[model samples]
Target: MLVDQYNPFEGKMLQILDQEGNITDEKLLPEIPDEELVRLFKIMLYTRVIDRKALMYQRQGRMLTYAPNEGQEACQIGSVYALEQRDWMAPAFRELGAWLTRGVDLKTLYLYWYGNEMGSKVSEEIRILPVSIPISSQLLHAVGLAYAAKVRGLDEVSIAYFGDGGTSEGDFHEALNLAGVYKTPTIFLCQNNQWSISVPKHFQTASETFAQKAYAYGFKGIKVDGNDIFAMYAATKEAVDRARKGEGPTLIEAYTYRLGAHTTSDDPTRYRDNTEVEAWREKDPVKRFRIYLEKRGLWDEEIEKAYVAEKEEEVEQVFADIEQNGGTAFDDVFMYQYAEMTPILKEQYAEWKAFFQERGML
Candidate 1:
């Protein structure tokens, strides 16, 4: 029959489960206990609910433009949970789930979307950077942190999260090159959701797969089923452990789909079809994980109800907190810039504060 020879690039790739909720590789599965699995599920549910609420808030003009991580919860949660508390996280926009999993306050996330810069005033104790919106710029920051850690003889690693579109940026290549040369402890986590805003992955690059690019950088590369929480956790755990052990960086390409608009300001219907969205919905990460939980007799209707109710209450409190704080204030904007504000910045701040006061808006 002259069947083609097998290649790592021409295979189904590494995975622990299928969309039908069947375990395909028992040995590669994560050793998550039942309680931990339940907690993971609850976190995903909470994120989903929060995303929905944020969408509603945007429509009601209560929040500025917001990005929704509707179907990629498992990818974010699994990857972040796999990291140690000492490890750093440098994220691009659309990493709400990762930040929340890393102990960022839900109210802070809400405040960020509400146009408050204070939302990004993460505690110095938390090893997370302010959300980078300039595409792949954070990759360099992650590499720099990794290099510094290595120079200081620190075992900590830094994980940088970006989308498929980010791979095309010059900063991405530069960061990877530096990480490779320095053998920094950095994990380049690329969430290939198949779309970068309205641009589809196929148009983003001609490469067969995003993971293959890692070969040019002389590092291990992996492509996993992003929708599978088990696969994500296992792969990330291995990468984090390797980095902590003084191994070089790894490139993890999570092949997943974005089930909603890129952001509230975007409309996917203009660039794609409903059929595609419907197809990905069938592989919903939350639903698949729920099915897996059910098969093990670990999930029930009562649990589902209770979880949803609790999530709703939590989201409600976040919204109330944001609203009561008058959303974002003008003074909050000038607090984080520098120890001493520049004269120009001080003048601008005073002008803004005066303008708000004149309108009785502050």
Candidate 2:
């Protein structure tokens, strides 16, 4: 039976619980302590609260354009918490939960969406790259960092998070090929949210599954229910362990749904149906996890109230900080480049500064 179950093209997909909050497979479960499970759930709740608050802030004109990971908290937080602090993280635009789990302050995240460049200036000690907006470009950075760690004899690994659309990028193919050939300790996590902007998953690729693409690169892959926090945690832990042990890379295609618009600038309703959105709402990560917690007798009305109150307070504080530092000066754009600025950049900077000064806006 075990021999029949083994297939090289079939990734080791492990899911512990179903959407109905029923445990489907207990044997594949990891030894997660109850306390840690509760902690992870709380972080997931925090992410949801932050996402909602960020959306409100954007709508109220208090923040610049924002991307809300409304239904992807479990996918981001579970994978992030499974990693060691020394391991590097490279994330695309929608990774607030991952950044928060990596110890980035909520205030800084808010600042980033508020048009402050300092928001992306994470401390070197944190080992998280700035949010990459150019799609799958960060995968190359993750591969390089993992390669460097391997050369330095360090047990560290690098994880890059991108969406299904990113899988079609040339950079994604290049990074995966190089990592496989060199055996770099990297994790290529693709959050298959079923839609890339307005395009559906059916149009993203012709392959039956994103995990199967890893076969061409000579690496193993897995597909997991991204809404299942336990599954994501378990799968990421196994992948990270293998990478740290010098077993090369793993491609994880986290199957999930983007319940909200791509960003504040997008209107998903224009391209999708309300019935489809309602269908995905039934599989919400927060609701499913809450059901699991309740079944375990770990959740209650009073506890929910307390958690909501605390999250509201924390979000209020973040908004306050963002308001205090809302404005960005024209000079701030020229600080983070190379040792010397190009002639064109200098000319443009001078023009922008003068324009802002004349308008009394700097």
Candidate 3:
């Protein structure tokens, strides 16, 4: 058969937790303490709450477009929680899980969705780049950052987050090739959430698996059950350790699904089937992790109720602050663009201020 003679590589799929919240294997389990595992679960819960609220706000016209990361929480939280504070992360727009894990404030996150540039101005201590809107562009920035770290002999790795469709972009290949040539300590994280906006995964690529593409660039690639938190954590931990040891890059194709609409602007029902989404929902990352935690005596009804209530109050307060403050200033647009505003920009800024003042918005 033609398929038998020309196979380049087989994707190594890893799964530690089953869909029904049972441990399939003990050997593949991540070596995390119970306390740390509980913390990870809490982060996932917080992400779900934040994502759901963002959607509610979007529907109510309180916020702009937002990409919900509801089902892929494990893929994001497990990988980000494994990284050191000094490591760098370049995230695409749908990475609230990573942002929360990295300590980005809820207010700042909410402000971003409120169409404010001020929200993008994250503190340097977090070490996460601003969200990249253009698909696959963040990979190049990640490669540059990783190469710079290598040149400076810093023990840090730069992780680039993209979707399955992003792999088809030219920048994706260019970044991977450059990282391979320079042996940059970079981790290419492809959150294969099944759909890139409205495009299906099979239509995006003919390759059997996204992970196999890494071999062409001279790096190892592994596929993990993205909904399984333990599997995601183990794969990322291994890749991070390899990068810290000066080894070349690794490509991690997280085999997961997006259980929501692509964003507030696009509806998945037009192109995707309800059955497919429902099937993936059964493998929901947060629900699966919660079950695992409960089995290990790390979770209880009281704890769940308390945590949910706490996050709800916190998110409500954040929205209240945004509503009361009239959101971000219009000048915030030009202020972050340049060190010193040009004369034309200054004139435009003044015009905006006058317009707002006339309308009692100043």
- By lDDT, the best candidate is 3
Q: What is the model-wide C-alpha lDDT for candidate 1?
A: 0.87
CA lDDT of each prediction against the hidden true structure: 0.87, 0.86, 0.88
lDDT of 3 at 26: 88
Q: Candidate 2's residue-wise lDDT over 1-362, tens digit each?
A: 11113232554555676789877878766688888878888888888888899899899988889997988988998888889989999999999878988899887788889888878888788999998999899999999999999999998999999999999999999999999999999999999999999999999998878887887998888888898888888888888988988889988888889999999999999999989988988989888888888999988778988998999998998789668866776567786654588888899888888998899987
Clashes of each: 0, 0, 0
Clashing residue pairs in candidate 3 are none
Model 1 lDDT at residue 120: 80
> What is the per-residue lDDT of model 1 for residues 1-362, given as tens digits with 9 covering 90 to 100?
00011123665456677888999868677898999998888888888999999999899988899998998998899888899889899999888778878888887788888888888878887899999999999999999999999999998999999999999999999999999888899999999999999999989999888877877897777887899998888878888888888878988888889999999999999999999999999989999899999999999779899889988998888798788884555676787678789898899999988998999987
lDDT for 207 in candidate 1 is 85
TM-score between candidate 1 and the true structure: 0.94
Write one digit per residue (lDDT tens) for candidate 3, span 1-362.
11112233653478889888899888667788888888888888899899999899899988999989889999999888879999999999988988999999998999889888888889889999988989999999999999999999899998999999999999999999999998899999999999998899899999989988988998778888899988888888888888889878988889999998888898888998899989999999988888888898889889999999999999999888988884666677888878899898999998988998999987
Q: Number of clashes in model 3?
A: 0
TM-score of each: 0.94, 0.94, 0.93
